[model samples]
Target: MNVSRRDEDGPRRVVVGVSGSLGSLAALHRAVAEAGRLGAEVLAVLAWEPPGGEFGYRRSPCPPLLAAVRDAAAGRLATALGEAFGGARPAVPLRSLAVRGQTVPVLVGLAGRPDDLLVVGAGRGLLRRGLRPSVAAGCLRQAGCPVLAVPRPALQHDLDALHRRHFWHLPEEPVPAR
Candidate 1:
C-alpha cells in the first residue's frame, strides 16, 4: 500500500486493465467511477501478445505478421472502450494504451507510481485457472500502489451457466414474445 501523496507523478490516476471480457468491462466502469470521485485521470490499458508464443515469434520473426497482430490488438482496445463508454467521452480525463506484452507485467509497470490505483477484474473458474494466471492476483502481489480487484458481475456467472447448458444440449424454457 502506497501511503505517499501525489507529487511528480502528477495527479492521481486510476489505471485499469481492459480485455473486452465482461469482468474487465465491469472493472473499467468501476475505474471510471473511482476516478470521478478522486478527481483523477483514467488510464485504460489493453495488453496483448502475438498469435503465437514469444519464442515462436522469435523463431519466425515476421514483421508484417507482428504489425497485423498489433493492429488487431489496437482495434480490440478501441472496440472495448467504445463498448464501455458507449461512444461517449468519459466525464473524467481519459487516456488509453494498447501495449504488446504479458498483461500482468504491463499493468504493473504502468501503475507503478505510489498515487496510482491499479484496477483489474477478479474472476476465475477451474478451467480458466488451469489455462492462465490471474491478472488481479498478479497485480495485487506486484503493484507498488493500491490494487482494486473488482468482483465479476453476477450476470457473467449467469451467462456462463447459460453457455454450459447450451453446450450440453440441455433444453431450457422458451422465452415469450415481449
Candidate 2:
C-alpha cells in the first residue's frame, strides 16, 4: 500500500516505524518534527505478526482479539503522533499505516525507494537491532535511500531539548568515510 501527498511546494517524504514501544514513539515524534522542519510528509508504519502456526504446521486465522489490539494500537499511535505534531494547523501530512508481516521486510519495502528516508528507533527490542545484521541492518544495507536510526532514550531527550531551544542544524559535512 502507498500513501502519497501531492504538494508542489512541500517537504520531502519520510517513513518512520513505530513498534508500539517507547523507542518507536520517540522515532515517530522525531520523524514528525524533522519532516515538519524539512516540509516533508510522514509515513508512520506499524507492522504486526498475524496469528498463525509455525512454518506450515497449522495455520490459524487472525483472531478478532489480535486484530482489535493491532487496530487500537494503530489508532492510538496515529492519534498520539497527530497530537504531538499537530499545531495551530496541519503543518505536515502524517499518514499512519498498519501492516501484517515481519517488521524488517515491511519497513524495508515501505522505505526502500530512493526518494524516501527510513527512520527507525535504536535500542534492545524487536526493532532495536537495526544496526546489527538483522532486519533493520539489512534494510539499511539494501535500502535505496538513507536510513536514520535514532537511539531511543538519548536521542529522544536531545530532540526535546533542541525543540525547546528552537535552534538546530544538520551536520555541515557527512562523517568521514570508513
Candidate 3:
C-alpha cells in the first residue's frame, strides 16, 4: 500500500469510523492526533442502518425521528473530535458524514481511494464477534490503503499491570519443561 507521504506540502486524508462507543472515541482521538501531526484532513463517518426494508413494497421511508438520531450521532462525533483535538478548530479540513448502510461497506468504499487511511476502534466482545470484525478486518483486507485499528484504552492501572505481567508469557512453552 501507499504508506509514505504523497506530497511534501499536501495534507493526508484520514477517515475515522465513529459509533459512539468508548473505543470509537479512542479511535477518533488517535485519528485527530495523527492528522494534526501529519497536517491531514479528517473525514468523520457515522453509519446507521436504514429504517426500511430491502424492498419498498411494504416498508416505509425513513422516519424523521430516525433521521434526527443519525444527525445527533454525527454531531456527537464532531463534538468528540473537537474535544480530542483540544479545541484546535479542525486544522486541515474536517468533514462529517452520516450514511445509511453497514459500517464496513461504507468505510471500505471510502478507503478504496489513494492517500486515505481508515481508523476504527476495537469493539467490545459482542461487537468483535459480529459487525466490528466485519468492518475492521474487512477494511484491512479490502481497503486499498492502510488501516489502523486502535484498541480501547485500558481504564484501571491493575489491568495495565496484568497486561504487562502477561506480556512476556509464551504460548508454545511446555509446563516447567516437564
Candidate 4:
C-alpha cells in the first residue's frame, strides 16, 4: 500500500471501471461518493476488446472497421457515464477513458499507483458469481492499492431505478455475500 501522505502529482484519486453493467454502474457511484468525501477526483475507465475468433484470427484490421468499433465503444462509455451520474456531471472531476484491452488488466494497470483506489463491480450473471470469475476479483488480486467491490444489493437498487426511468431490466443482480 502507498504510505505516502499525498501523490507526487496531486491529491490521490479514485479509479473505477465501468462496462454498462449494473455492478459496474454501482461501482462508479461508490467511487464518486468516496471521491466526494475525500475531496478527490475520479478516473472512470471503460476498457473494451474487439470480437474474438474469426475477427482476432486476422492480424490487421480494416481502418474503417477499427474506427467504427472505437467510436461505438466511446459512445457506450459516454452513455454509461451519463447514466451512472444521473445525466449530470458530479461536483468532483470525472475523467473518462475508453481503451482497447481486457477489462481486468487495463484497470489493474491504472491502479499501479499506491495512492490510487481501484473500484469495480461484482459483475453479472450466474457464471460471474459461480462458474466464471468476476473482473472485480481479478483487480482485487493484482491492484496496487485498495480495491472496493460494490455488493450486488447496491447494484440492484441502481438497476431498479434505471429500469423504472428508462425501461431497462435487472436480470442478474446477485444476492449479497453473507
lDDT of 1 by residue, 125-159 (tens): 88998899889999999999999999999999999
Which prediction has more favorable lDDT, 1 or 3? 1
Which candidate ranks first by lDDT, i.e. highest? Answer: 1
TM-score result, candidate 2: 0.63
Candidate 1: lDDT of 42? 97
Point out the higher-scoring one by TM-score: 3 or 4: 4
Runs of candidate 2 exceeding 4 Å displacement: 1-11, 52-58, 62-66, 69-73, 79-90, 125-135, 155-178
List ranges where model 4 is wrong by over 4 Å.
1-7, 53-60, 129-132, 154-178
RMSD of candidate 1 to true structure, Å: 6.1
Instruction: Give me the overall lDDT of model 2.
Output: 0.70
Sliding window of 10 residues with minimal summed lDDT for model 2: 50-59
Model 3 lDDT vs. the true structure? 0.73
The residue pairs in collision within model 4 are none
Q: What lDDT score belongs to each candidate, Candidate 1 first?
A: 0.93, 0.70, 0.73, 0.81
Residues 1-178, model 3: lDDT tens digits: 5554556534577899987666777888788778887778888888776444235413665568566767776787667666666767655578878776678888878766577788988645553476435567767778888899988777533565676678767477666854
**Poorest 10 consecutive residues by lDDT, candidate 3:** 50-59
